[model samples]
Target: MDGDKSLFAWVVENYKDGHLICDDQSGETADFLHISASSRTLSFIHVKKSGSSSEQRKISASAHEVVIGQAVKNLIWMDFTALRTRLESPPIEEPACWNSGVKGSDRSAFLAAFDRRDATSRTEIIIVQPHVREAHYKHLHENGLDHEQISEDTLRLHLLEGLLNAARSTTTSVGADLFIIGSSD
Candidate 1:
């Protein structure tokens, strides 16, 4: 597929500052993502199963919301070789923690390193981590979900509740919900 200009450039230019939520079972690997960022740079947030870390950048969630709004976008993983060809910049794969044979080289370590570099350089290696994967139940969980065609309504509600819980403690006011719960009548 052809790449988007604004989103692609934003993702390419600001990799280090993008949030990265490496779930407990997440594998050690890098990704090229299209996270919604208002600024030219990104503010990354990684919420692991055990706990989580603050965004690598100095921007506020409200600040980010103002610019990005509620636009749904795509974030896919592209290998190092492809980046070199597209950006016209020579490939420079510095020793990354995940494959570096270092301890705790999962999502957490990369987030930490990205945070440090993002702060110092104001720009570093691009790394994007989306909060939740957008897929239907059957598509998302593969064979884990019920075989019967699950309703999209059911899936959206389930994901929304989980997302709310995940974003509750976030400093960025990103999660926007427009629903009301009923009391036991």
Candidate 2:
């Protein structure tokens, strides 16, 4: 597996027992959406490549913003009734990149896991990069809106709150417990 594909595969393997939805193609909303039945957790993942240079990888400020933005956008989309409906009955055909036999075999469990009435589910917005660096944090502070008035923690909280609000507005009737995870090498 190559860079992007490798990350995708890792995500698939990590959540093998769950319902995985791939949206990595052009014009898609997210790289992958993993909904775990046993845990009642929904994860929206966005994968991006780090800069080639070692220094760049440690300070790719622009990449940080872009990946985080994309993940937030995908989270908002997840709140839509139409998207949730589609998620409930995902296409049977697995993406070519998925490992063999990773496709959802338990249709009943898959459907039940996403049951709109399950109001106590948790949601996560995950951004996977090659690595994270101190520069990324500094960049966020320096470039963030409000002339650096907003802290990184505040910005993340705002985004997560927005996602939870959107999820509540959906037919799911769930008030999602939100979390944001930025994982890197």
State which candidate has the highest TM-score.
2
My TM-score estimates for the predictions, one after another, are: 0.21, 0.58
The sequence of per-residue lDDT tens digits that candidate 2 reaches over residues 1-185 is: 33555667677767665676676766555787667756767666778765553654433335456766675555556554666665554454544322222564434444455574255677766667654454554565566655637765546645644544553344133333333344442
Candidate 2 local accuracy as lDDT? 0.56
Best by lDDT: 2
Q: Give lDDT: candidate 1, residue 66.
A: 16
- The global C-alpha lDDT for each of the candidates, from Candidate 1 onward, is 0.29, 0.56
CA RMSD of each candidate after superposition: 17.7, 7.1
Candidate 1 lDDT over residue span 26-141, tens digit each: 22222331122223232222212111122222112232221122211111212323422332321333322221322222344444433343222322122122222234222435
Query: Which residue pairs collide, candidate 2?
Result: none
Separate clash counts for every candidate: 5, 0
Worst ten-residue run, lDDT, model 2?
A: 171-180
